[model samples]
Target: MTIRLVLAGCGNMGYAMLSGWLKSGKLAPSAVLVVEPNAELRDRAVALGCGSAADAGAIPADAVPDLVVIAVKPQVIRDVTAAYKRFGDGRTTFVSIAAGTPSATFEDILGNRAPVVRCMPNTPAAIGKGMMVVFSNPLVSADAKRFVADLLSASGEVATIDDEGLMDAVTAVSGSGPAYIFHFIEALTVAAEKAGLPAATARLLAMQTVYGAASLAAESREDPAMLRKQVTSPNGTTAAALGVLMGDDRLTNLLTQAVEAARLRSIELGK
Candidate 1:
């Protein structure tokens, strides 16, 4: 199928997905339409050889895009979605990446008969290494699901959830998880600096260690628990560190609390 995509809101996340789609050659510029109110962003999309418009109304009334990707913020979703409601003739599917907003929100705005797929993607999507979690309403067809999944593959890993409620957990884990890692890196760098190492050296060590460990975890067939045990020799430095973190399950408890907090907040934001 010659898929036609209409991307609303050309912000950082939207632009990253767009760039990935283009780079992957999954969709041609001519087959994509970008609707961004920002003049500069509209020009940027136009420069990329795609159809650009300041509003969804600018799309020819005769045009029936296969997918309409809503990449705007949650606050602006209602207004942004209103622009594309006319396409809900059962031919177009709506794919939203707005955090906290539920599939029902899109359904209410776009009409209950309209197909909607809610997706959560993190900032790492800009580097094409994002993890996306998706859940769709019953209105979505199998073909539409496959189409949406293929489009998202341009960014990085994509997983579909049978239950939309799990999206809250997904948001807490992977969506907000990156910032936690970044903060950990920052804290490790500071600790290294306090250890009498040069600031530059400390930063390099912390950053590279995190990157290498993450890469190893990704490539390894062994479980992360096994990997951690492999590195923690008896009565060694690693064990000493683990004593503080793993002792009394302190780290696990702390992280569980953090994730639960994030999940509750996600539900609040959705409201």
Candidate 2:
């Protein structure tokens, strides 16, 4: 509760992470200072008992937080981060969740003295079921890396990568992975409806099946391939379905192409 963190945006993602941290007791409300330009968003942060400000300049001069989280849009990141260069003396670590913005952007703005961590988080993070991957620059202390990982875990699973280049792959796999799943749900729902299920039931079956299967896959010790085989019988109904979906690795190849397309787009955007 010592104002150890500065949250530069209080929009949906920022609010979700903040609420998760507070709910899990990973951070106390008094430990955060939220700088949200929008009055409504700032009010939401204030409602949670944290200090709220309209901008970085409004933050108290005496407040030197351990972390400064940038959740603003990537386009405005440079302008937004320029105001906090005073904290770039290697004491405060900068963490960014802006899509397509690299850690180097912060280092460029804050200078070599600043430590930066770039995170790729999926939309599911809003529901505490996200995949959060981070890549930190060399200047980030060992303890700071662990602390950032722990804080991110409040929202969901956390992973770290040594190679920043792999972040493009991360962007494809987890960052954009939710949309893939959502599309699958949409396809499945339509398939169900075509197969004679009511619209509501089709939607329910599609969503619940995906949700339950994902939960099982997550909890089971067996790998996904093994789990897939467990429910498939020789020339049975599941096998019949698998024949259409997995014949000649059709689904696998299709997904590979999709992921590659996304990875390439991510690389292009980063530049």
Compared to the true structure, candidate 1 yields what TM-score? 0.98
TM for candidate 2 is 0.98
Compared with the true structure, the alpha-carbon lDDT of candidate 2 equals 0.93
Steric clashes per prediction: 0, 0
Per-model TM values vs. the true structure: 0.98, 0.98
List, residue by residue over 51-130, the lDDT tens digit for candidate 1.
88888878887888889999999999999998888987678999999999999988888787899999999988888889
For residues 1-271, what per-residue lDDT tens digits would candidate 2 score against the true structure? 5779999999999999999888889888999999998999999999999999998998888878999999988888999999899999999999999988888889999999999999988888888999999999999999999889999998999999999999999998999999999999999999999999999999999999999999999999999999999999998999999999999999999999999999999888878
lDDT score, candidate 1, position 117: 92
